[model samples]
Target: MRVAIVTESFLPALNGVTTSVCKVLESLRAQGHDALVIAPGTSPWSPTMTPEHYAGFPVHSVTSVPVRQFRVGLPSYEIETVLHRFRPDVMHVASPFVLGVRGLTAARALGIPSVAIYQTDMPSYIRQHSGPAGDLTARAAWRWIRRIHQQADLTLAPSSAALQDLAAHDVPRIAQWGRGVDSDLFHPARRTDPGTAALRARLAPRGETLLGYVGRLAPEKELHRLVELARVPGTRLVLVGEGPSSEMLAASLPGAVFLGRREGEDLARAYAAFDVFVHTGTRETFGQTIQEAAAAGLPVVAPARGGPLDLVEVGVTGDLFDPDRPGDLAAKVAPLVGPEAAELRERMGLAARDRVVTRSWPALVEQLLDHYALAIRDFSRSVA
Candidate 1:
């Protein structure tokens, strides 16, 4: 089947949503399905913008302009005009942005079923960053999202937590479309890298421990907590991404090493470079980075809340710390600081890799195809 994916963010940006979509598209193509992607001309998540191609898909760019406090690209009507000619069997809208709204409109005009994926909690984001206008911001976001998603043939959520949240917001016909990890690319074996050896030697030259965080250095990530974990003397913190908050975070935690953003083999090596992986965010619908960390055979330390709760099996894969206490995160990760921690890391990392391998991209794409078939059947009958 041919499928068209519409997301407000893509290639030029690096985030969970964009990454997941790319992986799924590749997986679908491997299974003999055709897929096309449409994304914003400029990404709000990254500063350096460059257009690129993916192996299995073609991407089209829409509007390039600033929206609200951030610069974002709007949807191009020409995209819809082109997709109409191609006539995909299904259209999936990945974000509840203007592009996504256009996806729904275009799909409706073509009498084709469309699915919307609830990837982020815009309401919560507004509440966190909208200052005193947070209440108005949240309400506005809720209204906008409801209008955009209510008409979708099915709404896909990455986690059960997200499903419950969307239900509360009155989103209709929801289905689970959990994110997956590339077991082949992110396994413990990929950790072999000159860069990893070099970084490890410098940070733990005298046998200090390495603790890592891999994702955007944005306000929503709760990275301050990760920085605070650096108080433990024998631990060297490695942050593997850059965002608006990178400079401030670098200043706040002087001992921490910022490696910018690494992708493919480089990213896997970075994950394996660390003794333990840490996450403090409570807002993730699903944490693909956490899964990638696990796939690299690294024990994880994350909040007991959000997607990590679903991925990290406490005392088995990794320990879950109390989100309220950054100190608890430090304590949970401290065991790995000792020499004995190396054995634990290997054992836990193996288990972590095993768990993530089960969520492979091909399997996830096939499952989503099943959901599409089901949605089409149900909607066709309803209309009949």
Candidate 2:
């Protein structure tokens, strides 16, 4: 089957959506299926890709602008011509926003069956970064999202929680489609790598514990709460991504180390450097970084909300703190570290890695392909 994927995020823009699409595309082609990508890219657009990068797949790179608030693509249109040439059996929208909306609209007009994945919790994000009246803006965004996703033959949610949220929004034809991690790339062994060791020394020369957060440095991340961790002596807080919040975060958390953004092996090693992997984003629809952290064998501490609830097994793999409780995050993390805590931390880290083994990409991709086939059949029957 031929599939066309349209997403606002893509390569060179490090985030969950871009990485998820790249992984999906690679898996699709390996299974003897052709895939076409429509995503935002640099100034010079390319119709065809080189085998060296992106598996040499056909990608329609659109000229794009940076979203004012966040460091993500807001692609301008040209999806129609790409869709015309590719003529795919089905379309997949990786969180329909600027570019995805165009691709979905074109697919509907061309009578092509499409599937949309609710990768981001946009309404929650709006409430995060949109200042006062944020709640109202988020409500409005949810309605807009519902209107767009209902056009698809199927809407895939990463978690049951997300599906429930979508159902409340009255978006039909929804199903579960979770994220996966590469354990091979992010294993416990990497913790001892020369580069990772060097990083650990650089970040915490005084033997301070490293509490790390990986992903976009956006307002929605609620990094301000990390200040609470700073109060815990003999520990250093590090952020591993770049965004509009970089300046604000650096200013607010002066003691925290900002590693900018790291990808590929560098990213994996960065994960290994953390003594504890912490997630600050309470609104995450699916925490890919949390999965990666688990794969890296780092004990996680996250809010008892959204995606982490699906990933972290309390007291088994990692601990989940109540988002509503004061100092709940600190209390949960307190037990995972300190002089008397090494044994417990190691046990939990190993457990975390073990749990991530079950979320295999091949299985997830096959499931996605099955969804594509089902969506196509349903679409054909309805159109007939």
Candidate 3:
């Protein structure tokens, strides 16, 4: 099947949505399907970049400019035109941004089937950005998002938690797309890197804990908790990505080490190098980073909310703390700091890899193809 993926965020930008989209595209291409990507022309993360090939997939670039410290791409006319010419059997929208909405519009006009992947919590994002007017902004966005997604043949969610949130907002035609981790790339064996040991030694002295958070440094991440975590005696936080709030976050937490953005082996090493994987973000739909940490044979310390709640098996995988309290985060992470945590890490790490094997890219891509077939059949029936 020929598939077209439309997303606002992609390569050069480091985030869960971008990584997940890349994985899906890779999986589809591996199955011998013709897949195309429509992404922002200029990456917000890296300014000195142009249209580039991404891991063999052809990405169609569109006009983009900075918005709120990040790049936002305007709608692409060429994407619609290309879809008209190629006429992909299925189209997937990763976000309800302008690019994704345009893809939805094009698919509609062509009488083609489309699926919208709900990757972010837009309402939560609005609340994070809008402040005093956040509720109004969230409500308006909720309506707009509903309009875009209600037209989808089916809406794919990466987790059941995500589906429940969408259902609360009255979103229809929802199904689970789930998420998977590459065990080969993120196994416990990657921890043998000599550099990781040296790096750990450099970061911590005789008796200090190294808690890691690896994801976009955006407003919604609740990184304020990291600052509080830093207040814990004998603890240091290492943030392994960059984003809109890097400067402010740096100011707030002087002790934290910001590693900008990392990819491939470097990223895997970052996950493996950590003593405990701490995730404070409550808005994640599936929290891919947490899963990656799990794959690295690391125990996770996250809020007992949203995606983490579903992924972390409490005491077994790691401890889940109250989302509202920073103290809870500190409390959960404090225990895993000492020597006996090694056995806990080994146990959780094995279980984490086991949990992700069933959701392999091959299994997911096949399921996605099934969805595409259903969408096409429904579209054909509608046309008839």
Across 57-101, the per-residue lDDT of candidate 2 in tens digits comes to: 777767666466323445444677778888999999998877788
Ranking of all candidate structures by their TM-score, best first? 3, 2, 1
What C-alpha root-mean-square deviation, in Å, does candidate 2 show against the real structure? 2.7
User: Per-candidate RMSD vs. true structure?
Assistant: 2.6, 2.7, 2.1
Give me the candidate number with maximum lDDT.
2
Q: Lowest summed-lDDT stretch of 10 residues in model 1?
A: 67-76
Candidate 3 Cα deviation (angstroms), residue 142: 0.6
Off by over 4 Å in 1: 42-53, 67-71, 192-195
Better lDDT candidate (1, 3): 1
Please give the TM-score that candidate 2 achieves against the real structure.
Answer: 0.93
Candidates by lDDT, descending order: 2, 1, 3
Mind sharing the TM-score for model 3?
Answer: 0.94
Lowest lDDT 10-residue stretch of candidate 2: 44-53
For candidate 3, lDDT tens digit of each residue in 268-339?
878777878999898888898888888887888888778887788877778888978648888888777766
